[model samples]
Target: MSGMQDRSWWGREARATVALAYPLVLTNLAQALIPATDVVLLGWAGPKVLAAGSLGVNLYNACMIFGVGVMIAASPMMARALGQRAHNVRDVRRTVRQSLWAAVALVIPIWLLLWHSEGILLLFRQEPELAKQASHLIRPMMFGMLPLFVYQVLKSFVSALERPGWAFAAGAFAVFSNAILNYALIFGKFGLPALGLYGAGLGSTISNSVMAVGLAIVVTRHRHFRRYYLFGNFWRPDWARFAQVWRLGLPIAVTLGMEVTIFNAAVFLMGMIGEPELAAHAVAIQIASLCFMVPLGIGQATTVRVGLAYGRHDRVGVGRAGWAAFGVTMVFMVCSASLMLLAPRFLVGLFLDVHTPANAHVIDLAVAFLTVAALFQLVDGAQAVGAGMLRGIHDTAVPMLFAALGYWVIGFGTAILFAFHLGWGGIGVWVGLAAGLAAAAVLMMTRWMRREKLGLI
Candidate 1:
């Protein structure tokens, strides 16, 4: 009877985790699509536009990752409050309100910097033409940043309510709307002017703006979310919670930086190797990124689950939530890893023509990178979910340190040794990525396992 009970409990936890996870997964994938569509539009424009647009996009993404972390803080905060009392209206409302305030504070400085994006690129000694072209793309695209930030806060709000389907609905709408608008604006279709790179930028901005507004409308009008009166006051001060948001959020941003910047760094390293290697890295990274969304979504859902448990002071519930997410993440990672390993060439061909003699060298290198990417899928998922588990318990500082040590010190250091010193080239750089993720996975999961001993519970 005890064995049967254990099995039943695990089954229930697994189902609950997946129930919260699927919609979030689709939402994340939809978020990815907005950018993916931009890439497609740029590719159609030509390689020069594609390259310039990519540079602008990368620069914008760096800031997005950092600033959005502050907004995501509200998720755990609200989740915990809700767990304490299912209808903790005042507290949940304050968190959502402060998250908006935090979003406004975050956007200003980033806007100032992105305004001179071309100059920043030049400061880094990028090609003058590329820098100028990139600025054209960024200037209009930068306007969308605030909308994206606002959208994130709203997303967190809806997600915390466990009504993630609303955000997904908004995101799905953005996907189609962005594609259509970009097509018309970028290519001069349907009586729209062909503004090229500027068109892509403008289209995405409009799409994000509409997405935020649409979601805002739903939250305000929908009977379920309307009771919270999320936007109850246009102006109010919740200084304490506002500071708490930043205090808990900056580490999360830096932790994200450790992972994102390393990959950005690898692009430069590949550039040092050769054009073919650089090209291959881009294709391989995109494939890996798409696969990563599943585990990443699971991690997001895990944060809320674990936070709910943590708020109730239910240690067993916390453990069950965390492990359930980890298990689900592992299962998905394994399937993705197998696919990458078993059919690397076929996957590479999805981006490049396999039969083209001109593409052979780049395709070969991409296949090699995919193989390495497959090797690291499990550790990557482990680290992603582990960070979520820790974040649920309001534990960010130590994990930030772990990320710095592992991703930079251990991970980047090994990449340097293998790629340059040992003459591994592009392949060696991938090895470093694996090493860094592995180190983070081991350290983070270990910390989580010892949560009780460390008084985190």
Candidate 2:
């Protein structure tokens, strides 16, 4: 009986982690696919469109990161609740409903900001043509803001409950719809008007809306979730719970903003060098983002597992979950880095038309940038995993400080010095970034280890 209990518990952790992480990885991949497809399809529209789309997407992405971070607070809280089995069905239903309403509140302002993106871009003094194109892309994509926000809220709830297959199915559906829309709208296939870069934005918006509604339907219909949907009771706002959400989510939101701003600052600095350099930086960032999904997926699992284990006072389980995620992330990073190093040109060529005259310099620069990118993956993976582990312990504030100091003070400062004072150019800036990430990795890992020794994790 003891052996059987041990086996069952082991199976639960393994199955739960894998089930959550697999769908998350797939969803991350699908999210990446949208931009990957955009880069390919927009190539036909010329360099200006590509540049505009890149800038607009980067801007939007930076803003969205804050929302994503805020939403993550929900998962840990929900996971803890599930672990303790403290909440009744009605309570769970109320929490989920309130969360959705909170999401709606958060999304509205962001959508408004997106609508006024043209004014924001004007402040940058970007090339007029590029700004116009960016405005076009931004406008259509704004429609997706609410849907994406709503989906994320639901996703957090599902993942926390260890039901990630539903989220994966939703992501799959969105990807399929996005692909079809991109082909039809970008190229004017099957009698659709060719909207070029605008089409890509529209396609994303439509796909997000579909995914949000579809997932909502599925969740509402499911036996586990149906009990949580108390019509009149669920609709009312609970100020106390909302305040708790805000308290937990706000710091995460701020941390995300700072991190994304640091990256955006880097991108802006890259643009000052020239279009080719900017494009190269974009390529490297994209490749890194793809590699990042592994840590991200594992991180989600870690957060859930840790939260659950902590609530149960299962210290060993928490430690194991954190280590399992870290190990998996490291292995994935190594493989991803290998692929990037081995076929730098091939990877760049997949996005940019290498043979084209306008793209020749961009392709060459991308290949060069990716070489520097390859070395940073190990440190990046380490830092991400360490942060994930920390999050599992509900220790967010210090990690946020670490990120700000490391990325801004060390990373950006080093880049400015190396890029300008030392005449090291783009490679110098990348090296600075590597240094920052490596420092962050070391510091975070040390902190996590100390916390573990204290029995905090």
Candidate 3:
């Protein structure tokens, strides 16, 4: 019965694809809500608070994205193992434990270094008040790093087992929890003292902690996971498995870090332009992020599907998964971009009080950035899906190199020229970013196709 169920789970291409993609899509959307909820709560405080939250969240994302990349390496490895029917529950649990250790090793230095974030913020020469508020928000958020990593590791484990709904549920719970806490804490409601912006950070930290613990509990209780859990020793780390994960994870870590650095550089450049431009960039980034969730989810699905295909030595299945995911992502991106371009003001207004005195200029800038954003979503979606497909093949090194070149050499270089040399401002920076993503999309897809033809995938 177990064998039959496992076979049925991975046998049908379309059904399995949807099963994998839907949960991931929901999970990604829910993850996006964490920051969106923070922004909404802080927006009620005023523009300065919103700006500060934006800055702090961007910094947090910049740090965490690389950690996500490290975690991403696990899903493909696990998926391939499962597909080959060689994966043990004990080994999976061991990997999870080691990943937690890795997360701790990585985050501690980051936390200590960021203790002096005010100095880092000064590099952008941002408003002193905004900088101070951002630091306050950032410090508390850092405490949640370990919990966030644990949540991600569990999510990756669930995704590898082709049971992505568990991750989706965990993320949804976190999102709802965050929203309620933000309301209660931000406004001093339900007899709780209002912590204001600090409360917003606290809400996020608590939500992440809950998510981590909840997922750990649920996964441990699961029949599938029970087969893997050792009854007596839970804390023992497997050095060999840790090394394997690190070998697969390092390239992805560097790739994600480079990609995020390019965007952070763009944010810093926007800050140099002025407060309104920075705020507008923030709004545009949020809108773009919402659109991006679809591709990210599709990419995750592709990774699992492709990895499984590779494990089964089904070259055609790998190719089909890659193409299907890319096509689906493209369609979603087109519709999302069209909607945003058609009604930029209405969308921006949903998050920011456009009618307010402090936000009028920000709205105008956001509209302009949204216009540019519309053109880039297609390429961005394509590249992300392509990267996912490659990850399934365990082809991390070349993809990492491509990402580095695409973002740093091509994307940042073009942005610097446009923003400074050509005097195009934020619009130029966005256009350059679009070009970089386009380059990545074309290169990555071509590489995957070639590899497929050679039976490498």
Using TM-score, give the best candidate's number.
Answer: 1
Residue-wise C-alpha lDDT for candidate 2, range 1-457, written one tens digit per residue: 9989876766666666666788888777776776666766776667666777877777788777787777777777777777778544555565566666677778778888887777776676666666678778878877787787778778877777778778778878898899899878888998999998788899989998998888888778998766666334656778877776677776777766776776676776676666767677777778777778777787877888888887787887887677767777788888888988999998888777777887888888788888888988888888877877777777888888888888888888988888778987777778778878887788888888788576565
lDDT top scorer: 1
Worst 10 residues of 1 by lDDT: 43-52
Give each model's clash number.
0, 1, 0
After superposing candidate 3 on the true structure, give the runs of residues whose Cα lies further than 4 Å from its correct spot: 1-12, 230-232, 452-455
Model 1 RMSD vs true structure: 1.9
Alpha-carbon RMSD, each predicted model: 1.9, 2.9, 4.0
* lDDT, model 1: 0.86
Please give the ranking of all candidate structures by TM-score, highest first, separated by commas. Answer: 1, 3, 2
Computed on alpha carbons, the lDDT of every model, listed in order, comes to: 0.86, 0.77, 0.82
Task: Candidate 2: list runs displaced more than 4 Å.
Answer: 1-16, 86-88, 230-232, 452-457
Candidate 1, residues 160-253: lDDT per residue as tens digits?
8888999999989999999999999889999999998888889888988988998999999999899999999858898998899999988988
Backbone clashes in model 1, listed as residue pairs: none
TM-score of each: 0.95, 0.92, 0.93
